[model samples]
Target: MFESLGFEPDWFGLLGREVLRERRAALIAEACAWSVGLSDRPHHLRLRGRLVATGSTIGDRAATGQALSGEEDGRLELGDARPGSFQDALNAVDADGAVFADRFDREVIEPFVHETCVLAADRARRTRPGQWAELLDDLGEDGAELGDVVRAGEWEQPLRTDAEHLVLAALGTAPLLEVEAEGLPLSLVRAAEATARAAAAPRPEPEPEDLSGALFLALAAVREAGLPAPVPADDAPRLLAALAEQGLEPDEVAAVLPHLDLAPGTADRVAALLAAA
Candidate 1:
């Protein structure tokens, strides 16, 4: 399936995994930053001081002028009458940390997966009519990217999972290239879905590739979705080079097409799109 769109599943899988890992790392970093900010609070400093005072007894035992060594008490002791406050502070920090982690996991990580999945699915249904379900099924069938995304719950897991989802979504349902085939691009399909969803329109089911006019509509939709209009005169090689500059390949580019399943005419249009770009 991916081959038709110009991508090798294996390479794309690796890329997907990397993207997932990176995303999780970013989320974790953001959480850590929040933790750092909390740690800077005056309340935390006061609490820490109390904890040190209560926990420590070394000062009492150590010679007045002797340097305190780790071998002596194995832990630091604080001055009298402050241990309780310090303990309270430590507890607060711990609790805050837990909450931060939880929020990142649920709020940022989970929602990202759902949004990316929905976007991918919407595009698939538009581009690969009569095949969206099958493509989605196949993505999850062999424990490919789709399954990985669905299994993601943590930072790294979700990011990797999303990568899989993106690849699967991109390649999910490209229409065959044919003289009479539609020329829809994946981007267009996604845009249309977004529009429909916004309007509360009943989501359209995938349709079989029919008139060539669909290609124009799909291309227009993609443009509306933020992609540049199709280029003219660029063949596979030039297009591949251009997309490669954007960290993509011909196959990946093909997967982005909603009407890739069409015949030579549609293929030529794609080539032209690439060339013009």
Candidate 2:
């Protein structure tokens, strides 16, 4: 399965016969090499594959990957899956130095991105106002950017407005979802409201667009939970790059549709939305 996702699982080289507990620590180190791409299966695999192929003489570490995943609630799930919080894995290596730039981004940038999308989705779900307000305060204390945006107020209206147009394309939904906002956890609302205010005000040059990060996250969640994919491991740089590059052309869109697990029309719509963004 790992192989299908563009990861040549050289499990032996990565672990070198280490015991299960030790293997976990080792895996943490390997995954941290480029934590920015840690969420990207293809990138993670590519890094692991590098350690073995480079002629590192070591005993087989055994299969740490196997241990990293297991079934819970009759469904497969990944363990220690905190792409942001490294509470468990932090002790594996000393992080006093500058090797942890991306770690803060997990919280500073990532959560806002997620919260923004959740608000945009406006779906029927649990709503936590007190918790969200507290978290927003916490995020602002943790990062300057999010705070600046939130203080502006009116940060969420555009995203909710844009959701009317882009959400369908983002999630490839038809007939629209009946789910209500149920009170959104303050994510990208601050950013959206701030951008709107900026646009309304006069400036020498058009402010760089502050695109809502919510749409992508929403689409990805729907795709993973509802869409059919070629086993998560089948990911690759080409496919990931296409996703990162916002201006996806028709040809590029066509080329990647097969791998996306999205319908042809849905993929085209997604491509158009991305391109227009």
Candidate 3:
């Protein structure tokens, strides 16, 4: 799996299993129960089953509502039971519920909100159509690979491919402070090298914003592909030159190209540039 994701553990494990599954009902129910005393018995029961399957502490399982309620407060305040922390720290935060929020952080909402972001990141990384179809099948016949998910609309493709997939995966996972942390693909190394060169080139006048944006996008796409992050400063120029020497060209990078600002003639331009090179 690591090799497949370009030896990036962060990118490989970026997708969370639960977020990929149909979890709105459970999450909504958990939130409702805590905030407004709304209880979907079935939803609660399903959550309970998940808790049990995961072998979570009883107190932790019971604490979802309480922890959520304490969203305003950072501290989690358990009535009395002191269960061990959760296996997944995010999940544990949810398990801590209002109790943790009430005591430690005084109802700070960020911790709880971040849990949702993490879940989304995992869901975004999920690309298995078969498994997703099975899940939809469970929802209903209409749910299985619904027409909407099967076709490209305004977007060029029905499903994301290569670099686009990586970008969404990174965004879904959150906290993308650096390219190295994103675990992008090596396919992007060339693009990064190219962009860095473009960005650093000592032009007489400033470069166009589009050029800069394109360069950044190129670099980002490489990382999303699970390749190594480009080295910094002077080191990057050598790396870019090496990639160019290896015959890495624009066309070779189509699969990992960013969707941003892509236009009707964009594909042709990229293809032509790559082919000519």
Candidate 4:
């Protein structure tokens, strides 16, 4: 039970076991329906694990969609329904990890599927006389151990493995993300769509870029936003010595050049250099 969901205690004992399961199923539906529209991953995962534990299936398609964000074209955000203010307060913005994940999925996950399929067909031709097969005939026929054909990184392997299973089930009863129609692993769809999104996103054009200058400005913002941290006593003397070696005198709030000269910008520059380092 997510306390953050804010369900009334009066309703808790009022609902029977069946009703509770239904409630969990509904939350799972809402989460899956919203998918990436709900931007809280840790909470989402927690809620999802709970929901799945309650004997409700999100289904293969919905589960796959949850593994990655779906089409943003028609997504309606869950404003107020799922509070994002807490995560917003973290004040951190870094998409490099996501970008790298996308690349790894695209470059690694997709290839494993293709190579595995081709080599499996070749192996079937060589050893087991069979009708034409795409993914290993053993995939459908028996629970055979996977050969060391596709070398997938651990980061993307679980998703790729799930996607491979989905590919095997693509033509069967339930609907899917149409990834198999193009003969691709379901997992690769996430990477492909992400690539498309990245392409469509507006990018900042490089102009008269001063990376160090930007770092300096960013350092100022960090200092303002952050709690005052103690500078290490041991390191301060070393930094002063370094500054002296370059023929400048260092102080806590100010610095001097030899023969009565004040270096007004030196502190900020030194801070920026530390940040750059």
Query: Judged by lDDT, which candidate is best?
Result: 1
Off by over 4 Å in 4: 1-98, 133-277
Estimate every model's Cα lDDT from 0 to 1.
0.38, 0.32, 0.34, 0.33
Which candidate gets the maximum TM-score versus the true structure?
1
lDDT (10s digit) by residue, model 3, range 66-125: 221212322232222222211111223233232322222222122332343344433532
lDDT of each residue in 1-277, candidate 2, tens digit only: 8878987653222221222223333222222332322222211111322311212100111111111111121111112422223221121112122112234334333343335534322221124445445545644543234334333433433333332223222221111011111112232454467689999987688674433343454335445444344423233333434454455444544454554454335554555555765
**Candidate 4 overall lDDT versus native:** 0.33
TM-score of each prediction: 0.24, 0.16, 0.15, 0.18
The per-prediction CA RMSD against the true structure, in angstroms, equals: 27.3, 30.0, 25.4, 24.2
Q: lDDT (0-100) at residue 171 of candidate 3? A: 30
**What TM-score does prediction 4 earn?**
0.18
C-alpha RMSD in Å of predicted model 4 compared with the true structure: 24.2
lDDT value, residue 29 of candidate 2: 27
Off by more than 4 A, model 2: 1-45, 49-103, 106-184, 205-277
Q: After superposition, how far is residue 231 of candidate 2 from its true place, in Å?
A: 80
Predictions ranked by TM-score, top down?
1, 4, 2, 3
Report the lDDT of model 3 for residue 62.
36
